[model samples]
Target chain A: MTTQQLTQQIRIKKSFLCIGLDVDLTKIPQHLLELEDPIFEFNKAIIDATHDLCISYKPNTAFYEAYGIKGWQSLQKTINYINEKYPEIFTIADAKRGDIGNTSTMYAKAFFQDLNFDSVTVAPYMGKDSVEPFLAFNDKHTIMLALTSNEGAFDFQTLQTNGTRGEAELSGAKELYKQVLETSKTWKNAQNLMYVVGATKAEYFTEIRKIVPDSFLLVPGVGAQGGSLSEVCKYGMNTNIGLLINSSRGIIYASNGTDFAEKAREEALKMQQEMQQILK
Target chain B: MTTQQLTQQIRIKKSFLCIGLDVDLTKIPQHLLELEDPIFEFNKAIIDATHDLCISYKPNTAFYEAYGIKGWQSLQKTINYINEKYPEIFTIADAKRGDIGNTSTMYAKAFFQDLNFDSVTVAPYMGKDSVEPFLAFNDKHTIMLALTSNEGAFDFQTLQTNGTRGEAELSGAKELYKQVLETSKTWKNAQNLMYVVGATKAEYFTEIRKIVPDSFLLVPGVGAQGGSLSEVCKYGMNTNIGLLINSSRGIIYASNGTDFAEKAREEALKMQQEMQQILK
Candidate 1:
């Protein structure tokens, strides 16, 4: 989906929330475990319960992949269900994939063409050619990691870089993530780029916004990860509501009883209600 | 498999050659296209033909992921075939995966436990928390990207970083990849760690050896990507013959006809012979 379509959905829903469909069978309701495909069933219920409360669904591939072929099957089912039922909802495959030129194209085809996700998260460690393949697909977004929410983000993302490649604007020195943002803007078909900036580092958004002000930031460290939604929205939002505040365990696993979906909706409703007020 | 077992296999086989099973449909022979599972058939042929010439088989995950479910199935079959038949052969899942702590654990499980790969490649951008989980597995190897073969490697991996976290070595400044090597060594269960250092950057291996002399380096970009065997072996090899030099298109796609497997064996044999001479 285009940014315009995503923004329209956010306006209609009154929430820029992107609910994370990161399912783990052990964490879901005990009753659901008896089902043939517990992961897909859990996701289906959560999506049905909270579709109106959020504008997007971001499924981290790791959760599905851990289950092997059955996991891939569940992922295929979940994505197909989303596209068939809620065509308006923006889907993000938070796969964190990147490789060389041709290999990356295969990945782009896997996520964008085959799976039909509107966007897929990519790691920026491999640089331009690694990312441009995803960006080449018109209107299909590529969310590259800029500053992640994990403590590991500080390991390299925030380290000061001695700028090369004619980066004179930052006075020859800046953080690695900023360099990633600036350098990425110069690549071919860069307009299709979005970024992954962790909500835990809300203060970094102000600086991040300066570099890619119009680009959507898929913020994933909220709620269970201890990132405040208000602080993230305070600095990260643009006129188009270019922030997808993601909540995974906090909302999905709110209650593991039979009313798990209803409880999830309640948790999602709380975030959406706050977002409704914030949108005003 | 443990590093000791891997080294023993390398010594016994008299080859450090690792054949990359990155199968693309269009690239394979025309006859295989008619099969029920062409990808798996193709991989099986290649593995059967060249098992003696190579110490390891590194099937890049992108090639399998591209075809979605069927592709993943092919990957499963291929890995199973290698494990069941050539139990002595070291297996590397060139997945290049990394995420937050718990999530990384899921990915580690996906490649290591579920699929039963001896080793899996991981991207080091996320730092200690992301990678330490993969290292936690016993008898399994985690190969982290150091300096990649692609041009994009120059983009972020080569950028100079102002050292923090009390890294006083190298006068408080070094390239991001070097810092990756140094920092990874400090993580828990680091003995299980290996690295991916591209053969294209043959000169960089000299410095990389200083930081990780004992750890195995999975060097790609040997033939098809224009990297020299002798150059990488000269600078990268340790007392244990610590290098798994990979060649994908150069060997596997050497012939797309009915004699494809024979041609692939011929190509692998050439590399194995060269490696044998280097061993002497």
Candidate 2:
């Protein structure tokens, strides 16, 4: 999925929300647990209820992985359902994957070819080879991690590097994250590459947008994590409405009652409505 | 697995090698493709044949994830088999995962809780929040990608950030990777934290080791990618012999014939021999 297509979807839907399917069996309605695959059962309802309200559906790999083989099967079923029923909606395998070259190529095949997700979130610390393999796939998008919203983010990401004076003098004064954004953009055009910027750090958006104006930002932590939608949209939105604000537990587990699906839709609608106002 | 335990196993086995289970259906022997689960069968055969020759088994998640539900199942069976049969051998879920806080917590659950891998590769681009969640698990190790062996690694990892004006400002002139290593170490003392430094980038090892002398490093891209094993060991090795050199295609897919497992064992033996010398 190119940045242009993602922007088109956002504009068409009048929404920039990506409903995260961090489906945990323990958190879902107790009734669904009776089914052979509770995770899939819960995901089916959530997707069916909120399909139209969202431009993208992010199935975090961890949630499915928790249940072992059964969990992985649920993940496959959910993605297959979305692909067959709502082909228009973009899908993201919120699997933060990256590795060496040949290994990464296999990973690219797993998410892009086997699972059929439009994009997969990737970690950039392994440098380029671990990530570029994901980018090599023409149609698939690779969302690199940028400024994240977490207390520990201050640990190393913001630290200063001690490079030789000769190399340091040329690149100008850029923070570590800024250099990552700038350098990652050079791997490919900003077309297939997007970035995961946490909603809590919306203040950094102004500076981030300046670095990669056209790239889509997959912003998580909005609903349940206490990140404000208004703040994220204010600084993060681009001309293409380049923002995928994700709400996982806030929407998926909004109501653990029998009307879980309905409650999910209500929660999604609430965010979508706010996003609609922001896009306008 | 801790560096001491890993080194102990390496010493006992007289090997510093880690056999990478990057099992691809196309690359495996044709006969295995006829089995109920081809990837798992291939991996099982390779493990059975080469368990005595190596100290660790690193399964690149991409190969498993590419096959969808079945692929993930194979991954589980392979890991479970290794953990149960060879409790001493370290297991690495070569799934480079890193994301925002909540999302990262889920990823940690996937690999650590559900899958039961000893370590997982993570990207440090999003700063602490994206990575700290993975480090929270006391038993499991979080292998952050420090410097990769791919062409794109040069893109962002080596890019020069702004430094002080006249004097070589160690405070200001930080490469993105240097910051990641330094900051990530402080997250959870160096105990559960490791870095993925490519074997190809041996030159940078002296500097990297200076900053992170105690942390373990999972070095990939050695045989098939042409990364020098000796150079990597010379500079990258820590006081604890903190290095796990991974060789995937060059070892696992060394042969496509019916004696694939035997061939894999032979290839593993060759690398293990070299690693044994390096450890000495």
Candidate 3:
């Protein structure tokens, strides 16, 4: 998926909502568990019902991984279902993976080549060599962790970055997330890079925009996390409207009854309507 | 396994060497490809040949993930084989994973409960909440990435973190890794924590030791990555002799021919001998 194609999809659908298919067995309808692959069956229903209302589907790898080999197979089936049916919709394998260079190359092959996700989320604590391998794949995207949407974000991402570079006379330390934004742009194939900036940090988006004006941002705090969609758009919307606002629990787990897929579709429609209004 | 048991094993064997099982198809003996599960067969042979030499087996998740379901099953088989045959040997899933609290809990279950790994590596980019879930598992351990051995470590870990609390007039930013160590100590269940300090940055150990005096560190980059074993022990060693020096390529891919397992055993034996001298 190219940058232009994603932008085109957002405009055509009049929505930039990226629904997170983070399915939990306990949370899904009780009837679905009788199936051989309950997770995939539940995801299939949800995707079939709400595919047109959203531009992307993000399957959080942790949820699938909790069940072991069966969980991995369900994940494979869910992704295959998406790609085969909705080829136009973008896909994200929300696996927060990063390692050393050679190992990272293997991961790139896993998601981008074999599993065939358009993008995968990566944690950037290991630095350039860990990330460059993912960026090297032009057709694929690497969504990096910049400022996460959790309370722990303040613990490290927002810390002031000072001292190590020398020059005390220089301006005060830049925040860690800001430092990440600036440093990562200079790396190899950074053009293929996008950042994960929580939508809850709408205030920070104004400043974040100053650093990464052109690159798309995958924002995850819009619905269940108490982030205002309007506020995020006010500060985050670029010329291409470079934002992929995500909603997981608020959309997928809308109800536990057999009408779960219908409820999910209703919730997605509400979000799509709001996005349509904003895109106007 | 508990920390005491691990330390005892190190002393009993007179070695703290950790052999990384990062299997790749192209690098393994070509004959194994004909087997029903080549990766598992290869890992089984390596484990059989060198089980007594090293204290721990660190299988990087990326290598297994690249092969998809087959790769994941191979990983399951390898871990099961190690636990069944050599129950006393410590196991490390060198998977650099971290996420929000709830999601991380699933990951903890995936690695510790389902797969039955003693420890799993996690990245600290998401802060305390992300790491706390992993720490919550009492019988298991969480090894956080600190100063990595790769060249990219300089990109962020070493940067000075300068930020202030409200009216606190906080001091200038400490190095990112130091901040991680200090902040992580204050979190709940921090006793289950270890850290990854790359052997390539052996000189940083003196400063690192002051921050984490008793915690065991999983150190990579001993042989293949140009790290000196003697230099790593000089500053990083604790009274408990807390260090697990890892060598992936140097041990596993020692030879591409049919003598691969023997060559791998020879390399691991060399590391074990060196570690014995250091322990003395």
Candidate 4:
């Protein structure tokens, strides 16, 4: 889906929250085990409970994959359910896939064509050929990884580069993540592209926004990762409310009891309420 | 699979060649199109023809992904065929997937768990958290994209990075990709870690090997992209003949006629002969 459609959805729902379906079998309610596909059963309940409150559904492909073929089947079923029932909601295959040109093209087809996800997260490490293939798809969005929240993010992302020709302007000044953001924007206008900046790294958003003021940002690490929603909204929100704050474990596995769906709804509502205040 | 196991297979087969299964629909012989699954049928024939000539089979996931559900199903069938018939042939899901820990875990499951691939390619753009999840799976290797072949690869990958506080040794010296290679090695002792250094970027291998001496290198761009196999072997080969030189189009789509498998085997045999000379 395009950023324009995503913005309209956020406005219509009065929320910027994107619930993540990183459903783990061991973590879900024991009762779901009885279902033929426990993962899908859990996701269907969660999506049904929290559909109206969120603008997007980010399904972490790993969770479904952990169960082997059953996991992939579950992922397909969950995405199909969302598409069939809540067509308005954006679906993201939270699969950070990037490869060589030919391989990237196939990946684009997998997530965009076969599975039919609105967007898929891409890693920009292999440079343009790997990422541009994903962008080649007309309607699908390619979310590039920028500054992430993890501890190891500081390892190489924040490192400063010097003596580079095209990056001489960013030589002694900005961090590598900032360079990636700026350089990536130059790749196929910021329209079909978005940046993934973690909610935990909210403070960096102000700096990130300066580089690409219009591109949407898919912000993860909110609920279960302990990133504050208020802090992220305060610094990261754009004029169009271009932020997709994802809460996976904190919402999907909100309760291991039989009332898991109700608990998920409650968790989603709390985030939506706060997003409503921020949208105002 | 670990480099040791891959090395053993290479020795047993007397070849270090990795034939890339970049099954393009348009390039496949019209005869195979009559089959129930053309891609799988084509792949099975190719594998059957070249199984004795190569130690590994690298199926660029994009080829399968482009076909969508049918593509993925074809991929499953191909891998299953290899597992059942040619179990010793190493398999690689050339899917450069990298993301935050939670999301990456799901991707690892998709390729390593469900698909049963021996190894999967990954992009290190998101740092340790993105790459670590892929490393979490035992018996599964994470091949990180280090130096790629595309024109845009020089965009950010080669940018210089100044070292931080404790990393004073890397102060104002290393490029971003170099730092990624160094830091990624520290992720899990480099046991299950491999790096993708494109054959076109053979010049960088000398320095790359210094940082990751023991790690396996998945070198693409050899055939279709015009990367020099001789130059790549000269610089990239290690004590373990640590290189998987991939020839996708040059090998698989060598001839689009009824003799496609024979032609594929012939093309792979040519590469294997050259690789043998280098190994000696």
State which candidate has the highest DockQ. Answer: 3
The DockQ score of candidate 4 comes to 0.59
Task: State fnat for each of the candidate structures.
Answer: 0.75, 0.59, 0.81, 0.71
Clashing residue pairs in candidate 4 are A62-B106, A62-B107, A64-A71, A106-B62, A160-B161, A160-B162, A161-B160
Query: Worst 10-residue stretch by lDDT in candidate 3 chain A?
Result: A163-172
TM-score of each: 0.98, 0.90, 0.98, 0.94
User: What is the CAPRI rating of model 1's predicted complex?
Assistant: medium
lDDT of 1 by residue, A175-258 (tens): 889999998999999999999999999998999999999999999999888899999999999989899999999999999999
The residue pairs that clash in candidate 3, if any, are A160-B162, A161-B162, A162-B160, A162-B162, B161-B173, B162-B173
iRMSD per model? 1.9, 4.2, 1.5, 2.6
Misplaced by over 4 Å in model 4 are A163-172, B165-172
Model 4 residue B209 lDDT?
87
Every prediction: chain A TM-score: 0.97, 0.95, 0.97, 0.96
TM-score of 3: 0.98
Fnat value of model 4: 0.71
